[model samples]
Target: MDINNTLTIDGAIKEFAPQIEKTSPLGWSWITFLSVLVLFGFYGLYTQIAEGHIVTGMRDNVVWGIYIVNFIFFMGVSYAGALISGTLHLFRSEWRKPVIRMAEWITIISLLIGPLYILLCIGRLDKLHNIALFGRIQSPITWDVIAISTDIVGCIIFLYMALLRDFAHLRDYPELKVPKWKKKLYYYFALKYHDTPEQRKKLNRTVDIMAAMVIAIAIIVYSVLAWIFSVTLQPGWHSTIFGPYFVIAAVYSGTAVLIVSMYLFRKVYKLEHVITELHFKNMGIILLVLGAFFGYFTFSEYLTKWYGSQKNDELLISILFDKYYWEFVISNYIGVLLPLIIIGIPKFRTIKSITFTSLVVILALWLNRYLIVVPTLESPYLPIQDSRSAWVDYGGTWVEWSLTLGGIAGFLLLFTLASKLVPIVQLSALVKKDKSEENRKSE
Candidate 1:
């Protein structure tokens, strides 16, 4: 074998496989911790199911609660997977290699867990099938259903296609001590991908086509989610810019979560060489731009309503500016400002700071979603005639809080198991990239 090819193949089998082939003590502890949280989440779900929606803080006035908030957050995070992977592939960005597999994992895991919030929101599991049976084109909910379903299929295809080469690598590397069942699984997933020049060309072409398709599909899917809110007559949600606003926010939060994940994996796997400062800088820059876009949208959204002074819009604005003043300011202003400072100021742009900023942005964006959903519902144009205190204010109950944490745990659990099952970095893609760079340098 040629020296370069030998090195690439050796690295794939030795470096990448060892990282994934076994679980560490820390890994087991992490899984157990997440499992405990999931159990708590299931218990909360049981109470909500047995006792009804009353266990949640949602009322007739404020119908949507933390469940809807979490649904939006998870769905938004899923975009990080599609957008980052698709954009990097399209541009052929060198920085994307270290993080691409993690991005896809985030997307797959988020998609799997995000919809559970909807199930929680539904209150009655038996009526779930009614969505498909009675869904109409006129409803934004119907549009969301179709969009999520389509995106899930598209994401799975992209993820599987991306995994094929890694599967093939693991299959051929018999010394890796992988279980017999896992070896068989890898063989099946690899689809008998024996590495030949012709097969390699076909794989590249297919990935390119799918990458383009997924980018478009992911954008539309998230936009449809925004439309689910904007199409409504609610004061805060009824805006033409809501689609772009949502898409931007999704990318923002998704990127933040990606950075956080990148930091954790880098430390745990000791991939200092593979995931370096340059990747953090590039992703941080992207986050900076997104944070700016988010700030602009936030300003525009409130500025328009503040200018118009429409009674309903004004009331909604008051709730955001006055009642939920701290949350709005923190999630919007502080959230955007902190990241901007961390990324823009050259001195503060360390991996640790970037990851910290990302954590803040992720949490703040969740609060932003909560503010978007609840406060608007509280200040309906028609005054609250029910005269119930609970109907006036909606604070999430223990059941909602527990289930929210559970959903988060579930997302973490999926990602953890996935990391163990496959190479968290796409070794084949990295090899091809390295070879391309070498060829260019030689030329």
Candidate 2:
């Protein structure tokens, strides 16, 4: 077998750039609709930020609202695109060629929006900025700020570097008729790839350096965020496994997010040829592995709490299994278990079915996130100090709902616009001078 024939994950993702805009129009309208909604979400967010966090449901105790959850989720999701895309690229995963562009772009855009949630939560621009100007070195919050900022820079650079070859293709192909601004962006992004023997060597070396940087940034960002929780005195949040647990959970949720994205892209862009059943099937395998990993973490977490016989842990556990068992168990089983079984089946391996399962699993995971986050705040010590008249429920008010939907809509909108503006798949690099069989395979 040829040495290059074996293929690794990153090598596969390199294929995406050339074919990005080549697909049919499947997702355009939906993405357009969501883009408009994102505009609305931002409008609302702007007003809320101006008015203050008082406009939302978050009281003193419930400072961590849905926005925080979404923020963390977004940050976690960013990890998948950053680490998965860049990490695989560093090692050269052949199957990763098609997906890495989406993953990388997804991370860049996701990280950009993530900070907004925290800003909204704080609702004080002056106070937030003060932290930067006079931020304490020792605070986890400070570390989080530094970590995410560094991550954002790294993601943008890594994504731009990955786009280089694709930009060259767009420049070469007249049929694409890529606009002037886009061409300009592509030119800069391409960073003058002459594809010379020495230049190619330097390009590869540069990509390697960026890959390492991206991976380190992803790790540091997530670890710092986890520290934000573990540093707190909270019962469930404080744990040693919280670091890797956060990373694994981030990848798990992030993959589900990518699947949601894939479904939309396949539908909107009509990339049915590029994004095949094999893609979803491979993602299912990843989700299942993470599912198992999450399961073990959950088991160990609960077992330790049970063994320690902590009152706070028992109280929280009792509240969960006894009262919120319906959503809780359903979310876990359907989100975690059902996908594993579906993917394991030979007949269910088709893309259509796998896509369906991915949606189900994704929805279940969303509910699971709600269960994981909201319940803890609800079951706080001292019986939720909120008066009976106050909003103590683990849900968003109308404003929160509008705003949350708006945030989600914004994410979709950015994704849609980016895919349209540039080749979402990174087509140029993936077109092999030879090894045509390398295309369409999943990592």
Candidate 3:
């Protein structure tokens, strides 16, 4: 397959360059809306910092409140970036070309925002640096700090490497009508990339190596986060399966996230040809498999406890199934069942339906995490002998809710800006993948 037959370098520029060169009023409005949410989040942060932790609903019994939930959720969702891009690239899947760049961007943005929740959870922000200075080697917190730092660096390097060829393409292509400043920006990041045969071979090898490392690091980092919870004597979390369980759940939710993103970008950019029905169907199948697996993990986790009937474990299960009955049913039963049914049915596998299913899965997974954290804390092995009603009730306060909204808004804002800076789709990779596929079919 000739390069021109699969994808003319200039033709790709003609098609995708305008995406970066042009801006819509709707884009501005969306950015403005996200900015408002960020401002509100900042106000909530200020109030919490000024008023102290007392303003929030957290108490001695439920010391870990919504902030911890946000931390876990953000960290978990961040897995979508590396796991999707790294896995798809390693597998040499051609369909991944249209979406991998966006996936990598999500990884960088989510990783940056994930740690902010930890900052929010800390009572004393001024002493945050001291953790690195005097952190004990024995503490899981220290391990988490190291893992997160390492993963972020790895993600950034991998993303930059992926972007190099694309950046060079944008820099050299004149038909894109790119402004002078943008051309210079591209030129700077492109690093004199001239698409030489030697350069291409070197870059491909580098990307292949980085993709493998990212996949390994992604699995290890999330498992480390899970260990922080499981290592404790907490009844619900103390299990041998928590590590793989967290990794699976992350992939499950992260894939759902990637589906949602693909839908939005495809629809908005009028990229019906670039991201097609086949992409959605393939991703839907992946989602279906993960949903079933997650269901199995859920059943196994609780079933083990139910059979043993340990008093504390039973109490925690009761809190989950009895007290939080609706949440339990919704997240586990409805959440799992709906996706399976919709995806399993060929008639219902439309882009809109798949996107709808992703929204449900994302929200339900967040609720699942909430159930995991709060219920365990509520039913400590030693009963809450306290007389105070506040000690028993652990509903999150308005400040926490506001900050949560802010986090969501901040994530979207970063994504929006990044999209404008670079073509969300990797034209370079798409062309190369298409050429390879064409060659294979001919052979």
Candidate 4:
């Protein structure tokens, strides 16, 4: 069982076998913590179901609240994952192999969780089916439904294609110490793949096609989400730039998330050899570039509105500066600038610093979505007279807060469970790369 024999399935199994077999106490602890949060979130959901939207802070004047913000933020992150994974795979970037699995996982898990927030936003659970059954093609909500469904299906196919070879390797490896049920699962998913030349050719072609399709679908889907807001008559919402603006912000936050996941997996699994500083450096450069573009979009969006000085736009801007001043500054300015500064400067770009910058960007992006949703709703074109402050202003209650935290925990829990099931790094890719390098050296 020579693990150095890169030409064989044995190499990949030997290298990644430990990850499948081992779970640290720390892993269990983290899982337990996430489970607690998830339960708490369910409790909040139960309360909301029993007591109704009255348990939440959403009101007639400000209908959209934290739930919508979370919905947008998660969907943005999911789209980001799809875009990054598909683009990297299409371009055949060598460095992408290590982190690509995480990106795909982010896409699927976030896609699964994000739409639940929409259900939370809906006051009537019984009428949920009406959206699909009676949905108008002319409506933006219908567009969103169609786009999300298409994107998720494409992503799942792409991810499954990407995983097939690895699944085959795991199934064939006699030394793999996983349970019999797990082995059967792998064998079932592997689809009788034996890495024959014909099989390889077909798999590669399918993956390549799926990769290209997912990229196109991801952009269109996320753009459709932006159109949902931009098509509305609200003051801040009715902007032509929202489509590309939202896309840029989504990729920005998604890249930050990829970096954070890279850091965590590398630290926890002791994968420093596989996920190296060079990978961080390359990804950090990407983060920096996206941050710059995001900053430009932010500046352009506000500049156009401020320079135009329409009465409704002016009111929205005033609300942003006065009521949401800190959020605006932190999300638009500090969130966008600090990552650029940290990653752009050669001296400050340590792995820890980059990870911290990513954490900051994630929070800032969430806040960015919050500002986008709440303030615009608060400063409606027609004011509701005789409304109380709580009714007029949007604020998240304990229930919303609980569910938000639960969503984050659910993401972590899913990712953690996924790691136990499959090697976080793409084992088949590593094996192929190693074999190629060996052939080159021999020649």
Which structure among the candidates has the greatest TM-score?
A: 4
List per-prediction Cα lDDT, in the order shown. Answer: 0.87, 0.71, 0.86, 0.89
Can you give the TM-score per candidate against the true fold? Answer: 0.95, 0.86, 0.94, 0.96
State the local distance difference test value for candidate 2.
Answer: 0.71
List, residue by residue over 276-373, the lDDT tens digit for candidate 4.
88889998999999999999998999999999999989999999999899999999999988987899999999899999999999999999999899
TM-score of model 2 (CA atoms)? 0.86
TM-score head-to-head 1 vs 2, winner:
1
Specify the poorest-scoring 10-residue window by lDDT in model 4: 1-10
Tens digits of per-residue lDDT for model 3, 392-423: 66998989999999999999999888888888
The candidates, ranked best first by TM-score, are: 4, 1, 3, 2
Output the better candidate (2/4) by lDDT.
Answer: 4
Is 2 or 3 the stronger prediction by lDDT?
Answer: 3
User: Which is superior by lDDT, 1 or 2?
Assistant: 1
Ranking by lDDT: 4, 1, 3, 2
The TM-score between candidate 1 and the true structure equals 0.95
Error of 4 at 277 (Å): 0.6
Worst-scoring 10-residue span by lDDT in model 1: 1-10
Candidate 2 lDDT by residue in tens digits, 256-368: 77777777777665567666666777777877788788767767877797788788777777877887787767666666676677777777666666677767765665665
How close is each model in CA RMSD to the real structure?
A: 3.9, 5.4, 3.9, 3.3
After the best TM-score superposition of candidate 1, give how far the Cα of residue 400 lies from its true spot, in angstroms.
Answer: 0.7
